[model samples]
Target: MFRFALSLTLALLATQATAAEAEPRWMVTTTGGAFARDNDQAHSFGSLAVTRKIGRGYVSASVTRFGSAVRQVDVTLPSTYTIGFLSAGAVHGAWFYDGYVSLGRQHYKSVVTDLGERDVAGFSHSPVYGAGGDLGAVRWIGRSWSVTPSASLQWIKSRALRGQIGPRGGSEFETRETGVTLGAGLRVDKFFGASHGDSVSLRLTRFQTTNASAALSSGMRGAFNPSAQSGRTSDAWAEVGASATWRVDHRLYLDVGAVRTLGALGGDMTTGSAGARLLF
Candidate 1:
């Protein structure tokens, strides 16, 4: 965790050092939602990002944290943290490309339960790493509107045991997955009393998996065949979200939004969030 934080701090410093003198640009967002049948489990996430102009493009970095808790159970899962590095290619007229790589770490905790006068529990932890990249283009459609489309791929590898039932009876597992995601959105400038700099956006996205693997330690094995494993068990689903950002000043802003999954993923996983941003 310390290393991740340090890396992000250095990246931010380097970006700021090379930034051109212009209007401050930065974003911070927080989101929380529930998952599971009947919304029995809840998840929360938050992120901070900053962007600065460099040459004809932009450089940015962001840090994020997310965790989940059960509704009826008193157990809270460990939180995960991620740091990202981003580069935006020079704009060619009205088109450009953006890419990013991210490093992530997941921390897990033991589960605890109380039955009559007995307390039962077990705990464990693991660290996972992943990288992802994206390519996107934006084109002006008219005076106050534009369209952006993007595609992204992500992969993650598990490094240790992710869960446990008891201290003495636990197994190690590793996971690998690759995902392809596509997104399209429309941006409208100066809507609902917002300034020209302020914008509202509606976006739809779909994510599909091409490969997935789950490997267990020799001592802790399951009947599931390794050949039968696939990266994603569920089919692709669409997500729709709306966001509006209002600038309180050149350095301060507010952003809010709601996102819901449109198909199968929607039944148990939907999220809504709002947050603030500060630039320096």
Candidate 2:
């Protein structure tokens, strides 16, 4: 899955490169964020990306590190995720499209507590891969206002045992999940500030699992036993978010964003992010 996405991205870069008529512009961005669930699970992450301008679009690559200490009731799951992404987007008249491919791995340490720690034999790190794309249209209300309606599709496949301590310390269990997410949203944007270069946006989106399944197997000694189960599950979320970008100068920009979600799967989730971008 990741290989296909990478290949497509490279091909796009090649095509864009051939059509270029002038020197390309570039931007570097660094972002950091924290995510929290109402149930007390939390994680923070940071990322860096370099993007190149090509005609009406851009191509970029980024890497992100999600820090450790995703907590559970009786145990603390100290795990780290390192993900790399390839993304490309372009604007065509009033319409725009973009997509991304992500490849990552989750590394987990042994289950730990205040008293002691235990290693679950036969447990190892897992590979993660996913791809997502969105298409939207822009409608200008005036010189400084615009509205956009968009739809998106995303797919992911990965293991889910990184933050789980299982039924027992060495009980030996593994879970695999494959899911497809569908989203639709409307966004409104307004440009403000003296130069009108600083802008803010408000968005409302709904995302639901269209096709999702999870398989679990459990037993000691790496056995495939009767306890295994595979089934389909449905989950949905409604999210509202606001984000703003401040153009400090011609070469630098700052961004801040916050989001709130109402969902059935993990209760309500709140996420906040801040970032800076430098143009060259």
Candidate 3:
């Protein structure tokens, strides 16, 4: 009867396209690390990320690099380069929401030591931007375990610390900050293969700030304002990690990790990483 109802509607549309290709819309990650900060003295960074999924919502993009320290007392006087942009979607099924914006640029060259005579310093630049938003929720608690919680808000524009030390000596300064962050994490996957995967995580993060202050003068109204400069100098940091992924076949993949930065921002910082991931 009419070819058996057109072969049962083409076998139910090929079983809904094989259940949407078995889920997992997209994912890509790459990381590299080595960092230590406590008045400056360690460097190494690399990052690449991409995530995509639409219909339940998801989107992401990232790129990062930070490495420059050959000597000069481990450099940190003014070394920089950071860039990020992200967007997210998901209003159900584990809940999700995201937003991100970042930009940073700073170069170095500074030496101001009088009495013994040593000069020739000129290199200072600043370009900062910020925007942030996050609200995430995930729960699985079984078969591999999973739990995630997140909250964030950020607004910063602290860029103005130029340099020059001789031939007229130059300088510049400015600061404006607003931050709030809260995070929670737990992800354990042990090990799984067919494509390879391993995971371990423990995280805790906290940050608070408001209004900030810092100003110097020569061009922007001879600035210099510092009246008690808010509160809570620094206190809150924790990150534990373990990650591994290997799928060197389908579209390439490899990731390794290590992280440490427990308590304090003016001292104590550690990180280690390895990476290679490509998917399309």
**Candidate 1 lDDT over residue span 1-280, tens digit each:** 1011112222222223323435443433333332222344444555556666554456666665655322123322333334343434344444455555555564554433343222123324444444544455555565456566655555544432233346765332434443333333332223333334355777666655443222110100010012113234434445566767675764565666665555543243455566665666
Model 3 over residues 65-111: C-alpha lDDT tens digits?
56432122211233445646455545455555655666655454343
> How many pairs in model 2 have backbone atoms within 3 A of each other, for residues 3 or more apart or on separate chains, i.e. clashes?
0
lDDT digits (tens) for residues 144-228 of candidate 2: 7878788877777666443344565434345676767777888787877644657788888887874333210100000011111
User: Candidate 2: TM-score?
Assistant: 0.78
Q: What is the C-alpha lDDT of each candidate?
A: 0.41, 0.60, 0.43
Pairs of residues clashing in candidate 2? none
Residue 275 error, candidate 1, Å: 2.5
What's the CA RMSD for each of the models?
9.3, 8.6, 19.1
Look at candidate 3 and tell me the lDDT of residue 85.
48
Query: Each candidate: how many clashes?
Result: 2, 0, 1
